[model samples]
Target chain A: MSEPIKTDVVIVGAGPIGLFAVFELGLLDMKCHLIDILDKIGGQCAELYPEKPIYDIPGIPFTSAQGLVDALLQQIKPFNPLYHLNEMVETVEKIGDPLFRVTTDQGKVFEAKIVVIAAGGGSFQPKRPPIPGIEAYEGKSVHYAVRKMESFRDKRVLVVGGGDSALDWTLNLAPIASHLTLLHRRSEFRAAPDSVNKMMALVGDGKIDLVVGQVTALSGGDGQISKAMVKTNDGSAFEIACDALLPFFGLTMKLGPVANWGFELKNNELIPVDSAAFETSIPGIFAIGDINWYPGKLKLILSGFHEAALMAQKAYRYVYPEKRLVFQYTTSSTSLQKKLGVAPERPAAPARAAT
Target chain B: MVQITFIDSRGTARTVEGEAGSTVMETAIKNGVPEIEAECGGACACSTCHVYIEEAWREKVGEPSPMEEDMLDFAYNVQPNSRLSCQIKVREDLDGLIVRTPDRQA
Candidate 1:
């Protein structure tokens, strides 16, 4: 247990919408602390589709998903939104009207006047394989993702799954591993055609072993896996010796602890929100982005942007009920411009324009 | 001002006034009509603002772009008259624009 970090707002999920919400809330003089499950910012943009191009953004003709996140990070830099990455929110308890305390899996607690759930499709987590006794080697010999390639150097590695992550890591770790094995449920793969071809090429070159079977058991001592039992599709089981296991079973979005917060849920899954303010059943808690459901709710980035704007309006009232709010545009409002660190347009410089 | 009629999931009709050049989705949100989710504002990246344009006004609304049509795949119970309201710009000629929302937008 530790002292909870205090802020004006606590935003869950550091996705594109959540990042934009920081700018809107900051413009209103509210400080924000953002919590995300991934180790980096930009949620799915960075984690899933950083290189993918996104169309339909209003201003720019086109931008990569990560490029959009980078621009947003630069836009909100002046706001100094604090980020708590690599942590998932575990509990959110409303202490008072418009006041709540949020705790993360890492034991960090945050207190804020408003809680904004910008979690896009909820938190993306690795789907664990149904191997018996696999939990013992979770952080030891078994890993869902590779953090350091050096860790696998000279070690016998076993890669699982049929997706891009599995094939990519298998290709990357093959050269360094003393012995590498790629195990999947079938010979066919769900990964990109190129990666699958490359993996087959590796297998053909005898650089690695490809086994079509399911890992059924783990055998190890001292929390380290030494061997895995694989059941082939032909109903034959065999033992494969390995020291490191990388399972890329893909990611599943779970509502996680947010589901237990007791807000009225729509579809027994998504949070029901009032279109007026994007507020949830709770007075202080608000749901935005893909986590919310309304009569015509569309899970798009721009829609989340609108929800964030309206949510901020009501949040401002909750944070400062006695203060009068004056809506102002960044273009004309000197105060807002100052907060954004923009100098007023001055006499044009001929040399600057020529360059 | 342009007048737009929005039918909710329950078949309730509400007529609201929208400023010229503003999106139909924007107008519905501004007027506190819950039928149009318009989650993406006017980005046209989502189909949450899907609406059925009246047969008489379908030609005026025009056909959806390929991208809008692609996004409509994610909408629930889409019809031939379905259009993403975010792409429909309010104008003087659309003074009597009539559209109805679907049962839900996934």
Candidate 2:
């Protein structure tokens, strides 16, 4: 119950749309604090396909996914928006007319006049490998993230996946675990060569066992796993006894806490918002980006930008009830340019040598 | 038009007309076939569109690319015949293609 950080707007999900919302809100003199479950901003663009080329953005004919995120970060630099990363918003309770108290899972709180949910595809959570009855051993024996290395001390550990997460954990825990096994579907690994070579060196030293197989089933009792039934490429099935299983299948976006926020959802997934202001059923709480659904909702970055501009217009009324709002363009209005920190306009790098 | 048959985990078979050169994932999504969640929208970045090619058509469907193979690491119940439906394009030569969705996608 720390003192809540008060702000004019609290934007959930620091994705492209949320980042743009900061610029829009900043232009209107509304300060924002963005919260995201990811440790870094850019959401899926950075995590899923940072190298993928995006061609749909207006004006910019070509830009990579990470390119857009970096540009957005640069565009909102003047706003100085506070970011609370590695935190998931737990609950949002309306305390006043157009005012809400937001609480994160990490116990950080915020009191704001507006709440924007630009959570594109929701939070990226570790994919739960669809093993039958694995849920029973989730917290007890099965885990996705390694919060404490000492927890696996002296316990037999099974690390799954061919990525860095698997190999890194395998190498880190091999010393402490009574026995360690690395199970992957194939012999080839997607992890870095250095880490893979180190893991192989460990296997060569008899410190860790490498198995080319996939876990199909788990047998256990009372929320503790006894053994996991594995199937190899040749269709042979075997069992591996272990006290811990760490399956790092990478991340998948899920409509996590957004579903519990009391907003009316269209398909148990997306929040139903008005096409005009992009506000949800609740006042002062708006949803943008792919997380929102309207009559003709198009889940695109350009569409999310349009939604942010309009949502900010409505958000201004909540943050500044008695003030008059006159929309001005950044190109023509000196006041807007002043807010952008280029009031007098800096000389343009000598016109690029007139090439 | 090429024809594709998709069988869900429960063994429910769905036959649909797929346009040649279009992706198998696009055909399933357009025809409203369930169990094919192309979360990345055919970018091959995600493994949600994972499917197992029928043994008879395994050779015709061809093996996965190196990139698809890497993404398959995130999929469930992956076998030698498994493929991401997004990477499989419809063709006239493969007039009768059959694929089965896994019990769950990653």
Please provide, for model 2 over B1-106, each residue's C-alpha lDDT reduced to its tens digit, 9 standing for 90 to 100. 9989999999999999999999999999999999989998888899989999999999988999989999999987788889999999899988989999987886
Residue lDDT tens for model 1, A1-355: 8898999999999999999999999999999999999879998788756776888788888999899999999999999999999899999998877689899989999889999999987887876666768889999999998989999999999998777789999999999999999997656676788999999999999999999877889999988999999888678999999999998765556677878999867776799999999998889788889889989998778899999989988899999999998999998998999899995877876765445
Give every prediction's interface RMSD.
11.5, 0.9
**At residue A189, what lDDT does model 2 achieve?**
96
The models' CA-based lDDT, in order, is 0.86, 0.93
* TM values, all candidates: 0.61, 0.95
Q: What is the RMSD of candidate 2?
A: 4.8
Candidate 1, residue B72: the lDDT equals: 59
lDDT of 2: 0.93
* Candidate 1 Cα RMSD after full superposition onto the native fold (Å): 13.3
